[model samples]
Target: MKTLYIDCFCGAAGDMLLGALIEAGADYEAISKALNSLGVDGYTLSCEKVNKHGTMATKFDVHVDDAHDHPHRHLRHIVEIIEAGDLPKEVKEASLETFRRIAECEAEVHGTTIERVHFHEVGAVDSIVDIVGVHLALHQLQPERIVSSALHVGSGTVKCAHGVMPVPAPATVLLLRGVPSYSGDVDGELVTPTGAALVAQVADEFGPMPHMRINTVGVGSGTKDLPDRPNVLRVMWGDAVGDFHTKESITVIEANIDDMNPELLPPLLEDLLESGARDAFITPILGKKGRPAHLITVLADDKKVSAVTDTLLRGSSTLGVRMRKEQRICLERDWKHVLTPWGDVRVKIGTYKGTTSTTSPEYEDCARVAREGGVTTREVYESAYAAAIKGEYKDA
Candidate 1:
C-alpha cells in the first residue's frame, strides 16, 4: 500500500502541504483549473521552485489584490463558499471537515457556539485557498495511510487580529491538544491555525516516519525566512520497507487492584479506553490477603500513556500501575463492506505474508444491522463471515 508521511520539522501550513504535494507530482494545472472554478475573484495561486537554506523547495504563494480587504467570516459563510465551489466530492468533503474543526476549536476557546464563532486569520482568502487546495492535492495523491512527526511550534509572541498573543495562540493550542509538540529557540509562531487544523484533520498517526522505501520527496517553503532555521515542510511518499507487516512497538500498562469496588471497575475501564487506550481488559487474580483482585491492563501508543495513566489514578483507588514496552505483530488489515441477508456489515480482513489469514465482521456494524433487521448480532456476524468465505465481497 502507498503511504504519505509529513515531516513537520519546522511545522506545517496548509499552503506548504499543498505545495509539497504539487511538487511531489500532483497535477498543478488541474489544481489551478479547480481553483478557477471556485469563481472567487482577486486572488491567484503561484507555484515556483526556490532555495531555502541551501535546500531546493517549492514555494506556494496566494497573491491577493490590495483593493479587496477580506473581512472575517462565520462558519456558515465558509461552508457556503466551499459548497458553491466546483471541487470534486471527496475534496469538498475533506476541505469542509478541516474548516469545521477550526471553527469548533475557536468556539470552544471563546466559549461560544459554532454559529456565533467568527473566523480570524483562518477565514482570509489565502488561507481558504490553501486549505481547499490542500484537499484537492491530497485527492490526487490518494495515499492509503497518512502519518506525521512531532510538530515544532516556535516560542515568543505573535501579532493577531486579537492583538499580540503568545506563540501557539489559543485556537492553535486547542487544535494541537493531543498531538506531540514543542516550542523552542525560534522566536515566533511556527505553526499557524490553518496549519494546525490541516494536520489535526488528516493525520492518522503522529510520530517518527516509519520504515518505508521512499519513492518521492518534496520540500515546501514557508513565507517567513528565519535566520537560524529553514522555514519549510517536508513530504515523503513511499511503500513500507521489509516485511512491512511487522507492527511497531507500543506501550502497555497493567495494574492489579484488589481493594477497589467491582462496580467502579466498568466506568474506570470506559474512561481509560475513551481517553485513547487501544484496549482495556480485566483478569481475575489473587491478592496478598487472599482476596480476589482484578488485573487491569491497557494497550496504547506512547503518546497516550500519560493520559490513560492519569485517568486510572483519578477514577480508581490504585496505588501504582506497572508499565512496559512490548512489540505487537499484527497482520496487515483493511476494511470492506459486505452484504448479508440482514443488512450491510463492515468486515475486517487481516493479511499475513500477502494472503488472507483471518476475516471477521465488526461487532458494531453487526449490531447496527441486527437491530434494524430485528435479528441477533451473532446471526449478522455469521452471515457476513459466510459471505466473505463464499467470495461475496472482495478485499478492500
Candidate 2:
C-alpha cells in the first residue's frame, strides 16, 4: 500500500509540513490556488529550492506583512474564520478538525473549556494558512498510513503569548502527551503547538521509517539555520516491500485482591484502560484467607507496563502484581462505520489470512450511545455489531 513517512529529525511545524508536501510532488500552483480560495488575504506563500547540509530541499515561506503581530483569538473566532473560508468541503472540514484538536489540547493544559481557550501564535493568519494548507495537501496525498520519527523538542526557553516559557511550551507538551519526543543540543522551540496537534492527530505510528520503496523525498526548512544541525523536516513517500505486518511481544499482568471496595472496581478498570492497558477486567476469586477477592488482570504492551502497574497500585488495594510475557496472535484490524439506532459507531473488524475472524464496536462509542439512549453498553454494542455483520453480508 502507498504510505508517507515523516522524518522529524529537525522537528516539525505547520509550515514545515506544508513545505515538505510541496517538495514531495504536490502541485505548488494548485496548492496556492486552494489557499487563495480560502479568501484570507494579506499573506503570501513563497516556494524555493534550498540546500541544507548538502541536501537539496524545498522551502515554503508564508509571509505576513502586517506592521504588528496579530493578537490571540478565541476558539469561537478561529472557528468562525475557518467557516467563512471558501475552501473545498473536505479541506475546510480537515482544517477545522485540526484546529479543534489544538483547542482541546490547549483546554486540557490550561484547565479550561474549549470555548474559553485562546490561541496565540496558532491564531495568526500565517499559522492558520500553514495548518489549513497542510491539511489540504495531506488530503491530496491520501496515503494508506502516515508515520513519523520521534520528535526532537529543542532545549532552552522560547517566547509566547503567555511570555517567556520553557522549550516545547506548555500547550505543545500537552498536545504531545502520548507521542515519543526528546530534547537535544538544539536550543529553541522546535515543535510548535500547531505542529504537535497536527502530528498527534494524523500520525498512525511512531518509530523508525518502515521498509518502503522510496518514490519521493521532500525537505522543509525551518526559520533558524542552526550551525550544528540541518534545520529541516523530511517527508518520504513510497510503497512498502512486503505486506504490512507488525510484530511485537506484549505482557499480561494479573493480581488477586480481596480487600478492595467493590464500588471502586469500575473506576479502577477505567483508569487502567485509559492508561494504555489493552484490556483490563476483574474476576471473583476465593482468597487464601477464605475471604472473597477480585482477580485483576491487564494486557498491555511493554511501553505501557509502568503506567498500567501504577494504575493498579494506586487505584486498587493490591499488595503485589504479577506480570509475564505472553505470546499473542492478533489479526489485522480495520475500522468501519456502522449505523445503529443510537448513532454511528465505529466497528473494528479483525482479519487473519484475509478472512474475517472477529468484530467489535469501540467501547467509547458504545458507552456514549448507552448514556444517550438510556440502555446498557452491551445493548448498544450488540446493536452495532449486528449492523456491521449485516453490512458485511450485504457487501459479500
Choose the strongest candidate by lDDT.
Answer: 1
Q: Candidate 1, TM-score vs. the true structure? A: 0.64
Worst 10 residues of 2 by lDDT: 239-248
| lDDT score at residue 69, model 1, on the 0-100 scale | 67
Instruction: Please report, as a residue range, the 10-residue window in candidate 1 with the lowest summed lDDT.
Output: 240-249
Tens-place lDDT digits, model 1, residues 26-136: 888999888887767788789999888877889999998879867778988888888888887667767877888798898998899999888878988888889998888
**How does residue 374 of candidate 2 score in lDDT?**
91
Candidate 2 residues 1-396, lDDT tens each? 467899988888987888899889787888888778766667778999888777677788888879755667887787778788767655665677778878888888789999988887788888888888887788788666688899998999998777899988988998899999999889898998888888877786799998777899988887777888788999999755443543435799899988878999999998899776889988998999999888999997664576688888988888889999976555666678887788778888777656777888899999998999899999989998889878743223
lDDT of each: 0.84, 0.81
For candidate 1, the lDDT comes to: 0.84
Best by TM-score: 1
